[model samples]
Target: MEIVRGRSVLKRTAVGRLQYYEKEEPSVVRRQVEDTERELSRYERALEQAEKELEALYERALGEAGADSAAVFMGHRMLLKDEEYRNSVTRAITGERVNAAFAVETVGDELCRLFLEMEDEYLRARAADIRDVSDRLLRILEEEEKGGGRCGRGPALSEPVILAARDLAPSETVLLDKKKILGFVTEQGSANSHTAILARTMEIPALVSVPVAREWDGRLAAIDGEEGILYVDPDPETLERLKEKKARQEEAARLLLEIRDLPDVTRDGTRVELYANIGGPEDVEAVLGSRGAGVGLFRSEFLYLEKETYPTEDELFSAYRQTAERMGGREVVIRTLDIGADKTADYFGIEKEANPAMGFRALRICLKRPEIFHTQLRAIYRASAYGKVSVMFPMVASLWEVEEAKAMALQVREELEREGIPMGHVDLGIMIETPAAAILSGELAEKVDFFSIGTNDLTQYTLAADRQNDRLDDFYDPRHPAVLRLIAYVAENAQKAGIRAGICGELAADPSLTEVFLKMGIRELSVSPSFLLPLRKRIREICLEETENDQGV
Candidate 1:
């Protein structure tokens, strides 16, 4: 047993491991490699046999316990077949290999080093994922040597296990027992990582990127997911207060669930459209499930993220059509490709820049790849026939860019007509994400149908602070007078142009900012599904007339 102390931050506590593997010579490596190969072969056979048994068990569990239970059983079965992991073991076994354990250790160390060098905090945290996979594989391989036959431990004794690691992979996250697991704490990760996403989906308390997590062990802890705070070794009084807090949280959750079916109205009645910001068509299901008013912002980058080539017109059309069908006449505002040097698709082959975010990206990428842009436009136009779908271009900096995008959109429409692609008209809009875009909002507003203020990027651009950087995060304040003035300017310009303006940013979800936005004359607020109800309640409580009057003051 170990007793270590550390301050917990953001609902995560880290515990360091006491044991470390010693490095050995090449001869030791050869012997271990031979042993590992034998072990790998044995495990492969045992895994095959275990899979057959598990399949039968799964069928019986499905018969007895239902689909959800069977799904849990089957999920474990699939974990065995993870190709990247299997290949790693194979390399350790059959290849001119180092010791399996040492090889895993070396890979983990190298991954950690690689991640540390990465500029993106999210990507850097993936080092933890590599370590986790290697550790799990080593454990499995070691078990095979011991003739435990891949059924080494019975799902880790379910004892309120608080998983403390440098980071967690998506697969390990999925396999953990949710009921017994208290929460997740990681040394490195971001709110956007798959672990965070899964944690939010499962309603688990999680904290990431805690610098001193290595020092925590057996310390009484509390996690507040909503506030993104973690408390360690709380005094008795604090624990009592936390107990009360936990009760209130439970009650709030119960109330929120009950009101899920209710219309989003406050003590005073006012109609406010509550919408979801979707990343792709798959996210449409979540919007539907949450009973969102519409699709406020549909980020089209997911189409470019994993693809080696740009999506064809037909592919884009099918995606848009599916989203439109799911939205069922609700407004779907699709934002055009926003990729840049920071987020390169293989097809784009974007050159890495010193400051990728500030360099050629977003709308700049579209300008450089007009053919790709035209194909997307044609598809969106064709999909418009299915429902009320509108198009928006991201990172527009000037009236010229807006005009150019509009011209390209029109050209796509003309081309579609000539090609007989069954196109329909859709409203074209521009996102105010860059500093220059905010500065020229009045002129740009005249060219676009509407404006969606992407506050995340706007804040970053305005403050010259990378929000991902912890050291400079304090400078990334959205409520900075400059940011407020920019939003106000854009909204005013949008209104003057006879077009509605919407805010679809992390700031939109902040209840405290709702009145400020309403005062700014913003017509819509698109936020995450979790925040929709609370924000809608805030909107309804606001007297827009009073807010507008106060704006002039």
Candidate 2:
């Protein structure tokens, strides 16, 4: 194979000349369904036999090598139980069928077509799941035919294995030995995908959306996930440089940890509250480990996404209480369910819309599902009694939405009181994400106790560009004049209202925007723990009077 390489996103899948576009008549569909059911039954029987054989292997391995070998065997069992993998096979069986010769090829072709048509990079890359499932199934079938009778060896575990995939499913990413996985290189993915988020949380280096990466088989490569760059087939000298760079990174990380305990202050004497944006209760440990000032934004959607059913009041209460208690006296701002059009809850059965981002989401979903919303409201209210808890509504567009949300919150509070449930008052806040919300900041300030500018959505809406679109990424500027203007408007309104305004968006963590945000009179800036000290130092360096004086310039 000629070594033709391109600088591409690691997660982009290869498109091949697979004939899946052939028209399927009604008869074909019926025949395919019947064949699929038979194939599924055959696989089920094979899977059963594989399980028995696996158990036998485990017993033999354990008898020979003790519990350590059995542990490795058990790990494979857990991997087999992965829901995403199981679901992929189920989907394949239910949706289409063909002879083994054509099944894998057809699935691959269909997945490629589906991926190409998808607008979201994250969803588009789901084609990889189809490929991964088919590949595994084909291997199992081949082994069975060859009378190998199920290969039982565990995956070759390595330290810092660069996971190269078309795209990683959540289950694959979650189950991977994070410590051993050095970095991830995918043909497709965005920063918001579960794999990307998990990699970031784990501090694993990752590069995504590399077009035609599968063609670069076994080529010497170097990647810096922190910088989102990949170096293909580096010479010895380049490899040496990378090694030096790695050493510097390790040293810098070590130094950062050493100084983490110190108060973030610059040459001057200004202080900034550096907080962490957390996903779940489990994230609280990491936040505390980093000595975060408080939980700035507790993404409550995690609870909704992880469970099959809506989180009950007591379950919600425990989660909120755990977070609050972990933070101790520090402020914890809990963002209400931000789910809407695109991110529908299976249990809620939210209808899919043409434009999910603009349609019912966040606070909008709560209005439709009052019972679910009320449960969350009650939990937040109850948790407030433990520590400082602020309830923030996301994607607030109109004064009516804010009013309705606040009224419902109060209703929940009243219901709790009538039942003699112990609860406390919470500071109500609105996320200024939409242009409508930003434009009406003065009006919104009147109703809400605080404002948090969500720059991610704000930038996207203002620029009229999908942030995930690589072609439109050039327009996703946080520093754009219009975006800055919206931030200024919200800050000015919050100042006039005499209520604190903060930023919990990705922009808040940006070192470049730290001074600009401070100049705009933002009182609090909540960022990831990694950015805390640098931001704190940046704040300390600026004199408030000098900042205010330089505002005109």
Give lDDT: candidate 2, residue 401. 92
- What lDDT does the true structure give each of the candidates? 0.66, 0.66
- Can you write out model 1's per-residue Cα lDDT over 1-553, one digit (the tens) per residue? 2222222332322221211112111221334544666555654764565456556654543333222223333434543454545565567656644555555555556656876798765345445545544455555545555766533222342366555666665544555566666676676556655556556545556677654354555556665555555566666775676677777766766665555566654344555567888766767766776678898888777666534467788988888999998899998999898776334554566664656777878788788878778888888999998988999999887777888888898888887789877755688888888889988988887787888999988998899877655455456688899999999999998888898898998789878888778767776888866666666556656776665466684
Query: What count of clashes does model 1 give?
Result: 3
For model 2, residues 64-180, the per-residue Cα lDDT tens digits are: 322222333333443344454455555666665543324444555565677668776534544554544444445555566577642433223444455556666443454556455
Where does candidate 2 stray beyond 4 Å? Answer: 1-194, 209-221, 224-243, 530-553
Each candidate structure's TM-score, on Cα atoms with residue i matched to residue i, is: 0.74, 0.74
Clashing pairs in 1: 11-229, 11-230, 340-361
Q: For candidate 1, give the lDDT.
A: 0.66
